[model samples]
Target: MSEEVIQYTVAPAPPEPPRVPVRYAGFWIRFWAYVTDLIIVGAINGIILLPFIPNGGREFTIGFWTLTGVISTIVLYLYFLLMTKFSSQTLGKMIFGIKVIRKDGNLPSWSDLVFREIVGRFLHRVLVVTNLLYIVVGFAERKKGIHDMIADTRVIHTNK
Candidate 1:
């Protein structure tokens, strides 16, 4: 009987690309970005609501207010969803030269944009205390907000 010997060889892992340092956006920068977005959205909402707003105070019923609120919300959501999904930046972000990217270093997908822009943002707005989540931008190495964390994303500078 002849005995056969088996040999095994392990290949070395591929060398990773040189690491480029990521420049994180700070709290102040992010705050301004948010403000810019608010102004843009508010302006659009104002224009849309203008026609519907009654001429005098008599029509300011609860139903009118509720309907206005819902319209504003839908417009805001659609704005964020479509803009972020396509460009990874809203007008505010574009102006600020910042953009959202997946934490894993991939470009954000539609679902990621949806979660970050709609779900996470809605929760952040509703929970007033969560507004403090912006503090994380000051301290976190990645300068990620609660919404960014929830959506596994990071806001990054485009110039760099």
Candidate 2:
């Protein structure tokens, strides 16, 4: 006696949708965002330092650093660090509809934010000469500043 065998076939999976391309923010937009951020930071520092400035705090110096200068630096670092850590963008970036993202397409970690905001940005601001480093953002193909490159990050538009 001969036995009959049946074969079952599975259907093919559907194709995935096409991916949209990412758009990197250019220098001009980034510059405007930075300017807006500076205004906000200045407002914050002014409010916080008001009481202390009455005692010559603005001119007070600790070695080469003025009292207000030090405080301002700390405030700046905290603003960038905390903003990027929690939301991956500052108020300026959000207003401009741009955001910082890891080059590998992952969310940045605390260490990455710290490096980008504190260490890298500090280097740029530590001396008058180094501030020119920001100009590189305009020349870089990825529209990354030194700090962004240091942290392996990219600033991209959300179009929102």
Candidate 3:
């Protein structure tokens, strides 16, 4: 009869520790990423346009260069938009260990990626002074650039 009385006690699982605060990529890291991307784009541009130069970078007419500029701009925008859309990281971003994400901690959808890479980034370059969005990056709690803010995106370290 003594073996007939068995009691069961259940222990609750321990609470999960709070998640570590997310860290935003800093200005200099982002800057270097941009510079690296520029180098890549510049090299590609030079290769594609060199044949059109005809005299080793010294004999292009205004019309030729104007067309070249348009082509280069299109190429640049496509490069940024496609890369960001498919991978959320361009070559430079991959090398630099950063990525673009929506503010809600999710990957961006195609439209969002397009707006960010095109209207935000491409236009930012065309309108150079908008590059000063870095000022906001330096001051904002999330370190977001104007492009990032406009697209409701954030750049974060991936440690990859």
Name the candidate that leads on lDDT: 2
Candidate 3 lDDT over 92-144, as tens digits, reads 99999999999887889888877788888765775678667666787887998
Candidate numbers, best lDDT first, in rank order: 2, 1, 3
Model 3 lDDT, full chain set: 0.82
Which stretches of model 3 miss by more than 4 angstroms? Answer: 1-21, 55-65
Backbone clash numbers for all candidates listed: 0, 0, 0
Candidate 2: residue pairs that collide: none
For candidate 2, the 10 contiguous residues with the lowest summed lDDT are: 51-60
Give a tens-digit lDDT track for model 2, residues 62-158.
9998788889888988998999889989999999999998987667999888889998998998799999999999999799999998899999998
Q: TM per model? A: 0.80, 0.84, 0.76
Per-residue lDDT tens digits for candidate 1, residues 77-112, read 998888888888889889999888898777899888
User: Model 1 reaches what TM-score against the true structure?
Assistant: 0.80
Candidate 1 clashing pairs, residues 3+ apart or interchain: none
Compare candidates 1 and 3 on TM-score and give the better one. Answer: 1
Model 1: residues >4 Å from true position, as ranges? 1-19, 57-65
| Deviation (Å) of 155 in candidate 3 | 0.4
Which candidate, 1 or 2, would have the higher lDDT against the true structure? 2
Error of 3 at 91 (Å): 1.0
